[model samples]
Target: MRRGTGHLMNTSVTVWRVVLADDGGGGQTEAWAPQGEQPARLSQPTARQREVGDQENAHLTHVVYLRPGVDVRRGDQLRQPGLRLEVVAVFEPSVRGTYLRADCTSRQAEGE
Candidate 1:
């Protein structure tokens, strides 16, 4: 992922379906809401994460600041457990950062 290198970027965004559980107070509660799906704008390693989080993801992390129409408060999709995202966004020149690998990005969408 270097500058001026137009690699496979369009298939870079990681799309995920967010199921938000409501905080209900009754015995029969906790309804799941289908939040609008969003993508994880990926970027190259910052030299810091490369040394951390073992070597599985090695240095991959979602760039929250670059994701448009996404809430900057909390990365809801990035926080979801067992969530493997699918690549959908048509890649173009990001006015923010560079996307790295497609291993975790190019997944098929989950069955509804």
Candidate 2:
């Protein structure tokens, strides 16, 4: 636990990276490879954030908080049970070593 972050991450999500694999036809196919799981706290965007996303047609949905040094990045996929979120952006606090935040969009159809 880092300072006040004790137990803040109440759940874990598996992080997946899309890799290009040889399709044996001189072409590559995108494949989802698990990058392992990490502790995370998934939250819905606030009213203001939601409004901004709506105006921009971004469909931004969840904000995921993870401990610093987690191997996550934009374009990665975060998955838990019935939900899948596509990571849109990754941010680090100015103070550093506090936590990492990921702005994500819901991929409802993929989960179905």
lDDT of candidates 1 onward, in order: 0.36, 0.89
Error of 1 at 111 (Å): 14
Candidate 2: tens digits of C-alpha lDDT, residues 49-91: 8888778776789999998889899999999988899998899
Candidate 1 local Cα displacement, residue 85, angstroms: 6.8
Please give the range of 10 consecutive residues that has the lowest summed lDDT in model 2. 1-10
Q: Which ranges in model 1 have alpha carbons more than 4 Å from their true place?
A: 1-25, 28-32, 50-65, 72-75, 78-112
| Candidate 2 Cα misplacement greater than 4 A, ranges | 1-6
Model 1 lDDT, full chain set: 0.36
Query: For model 2, how many clashes?
Result: 0
What lDDT score is found at residue 3 in candidate 1?
62
> How many clashing residue pairs appear in each of the predictions shown?
1, 0
